[model samples]
Target: MDTGVEGRKASRVGVRVSAVSKTIKGNRVLDGVSASFPLARVSGIRGHNGSGKTMLLRAIAGLISIDEGSIEVFGEKLDARGDFPVGIGFMVEPLELWDEFTGLEMLTLLSSLRGRPRENHLRSALTRMGLDPDDLRRIKSFSLGMKQRLNLAQGLMDAPRLLLLDEPTNALDEDGQEAIRQVLIEERDRGTTIIVVSHDREELDRIADVQFIMGDGRIREV
Candidate 1:
């Protein structure tokens, strides 16, 4: 995608949040946060623990309902009735996987739940994530980094228009982290709108087209 000033000016907004707020169990997690993410760009969010970065992503993904305000994805307003945005791929923190399934088997099962993706496509996704698609080891035997890769592969295999990732580099080594960075950049260049949350400021600076910092349930562009 174009990074020039005119190109940026011509870009359309992919996700828009209007005065959104959410309180969970009497604790305010998001305090009237509002932001716009441009299509075909990588937007990065950074904040300390409990600063509501993850919660904000969750709200955008429609995994949690905002107590007030509105969120729109590709011009469609998100409903409070747990309706997820169409054409979205998200991998939030606290990864969950089927412990009894192998990497390929798990992804195959997940893809089956949505639509019938080719078996070869599933294998290619695993290979791109540096996983051995033919490995028969169960997920329970995989290490933390391997599990993280599997989680990302599942989210990205479908090639959605919008991608939301929270701490995508967690548990990854230097090479693995670099691989993810390249993948994010490649996706952005392919006109995919990406919103990523990371604690590494330097990494965000390198990959993010725009950056936001969250504190005390509030957000400010940085």
Candidate 2:
């Protein structure tokens, strides 16, 4: 809900995927895909199940190795063997969180890992996602929607330069989904390069500066 951050342009450095290919269990997931995502804008990808959308995101996050080709973020190559790419925040398909930890605590842990302060940004991110920052309930007690919100909170807490979210609006009511859209719009305006995968075409049309349609292990702009 803060529109003040709007209009800040990204520093013109973004991501490039060149001839990326991946295979799992003898099935081709990404077949020589290549694309460039501009900074400070949102790129939306829409696809059916098993269309390799999530796989592509994981590869960009360096969570999985590509069978061939390369991914570059801000002009730097992403290596799975190296530390997580700096200024990158991602929420792929399988989000792992500590069940016993409170929402705030979970974000605190991530902030610690990134060597950043937690108190302010943690609360801000939670509230922006329509969750109560003061709630002390364990993450295990959260509903599906709340858990999804928490997943988003953690990704946004670090103020990442490059954000990758898959099915970001899953398990949420319209209000909650709208809140996320607004947050993403603000982030995009402030020069945070973002890539989102969603089944909702309306959401994609509203937010994505460029759109990609994925099918049969290949991605193409529409």
Best by lDDT: 1
lDDT of 2 at 41: 81
RMSD of each: 1.8, 3.5
Estimate TM-scores for all models. Answer: 0.94, 0.90
lDDT of 1 by residue, 25-137 (tens): 99999999999888888999999999999999999998998889999898889996547777888899786799999999999888887776768878877888899999999
Candidate 1, position 222, lDDT: 79
Per-residue C-alpha lDDT of model 2 across residues 13-80, encoded as one tens digit per residue: 48898998888899999999898887778889999998988888888887888888889999999884
Which 10 consecutive residues of model 2 have the lowest summed lDDT? Answer: 1-10
Candidate 1: regions farther than 4 A off: 1-10
Q: Which ten residues in a row have the lowest lDDT in candidate 1?
A: 1-10
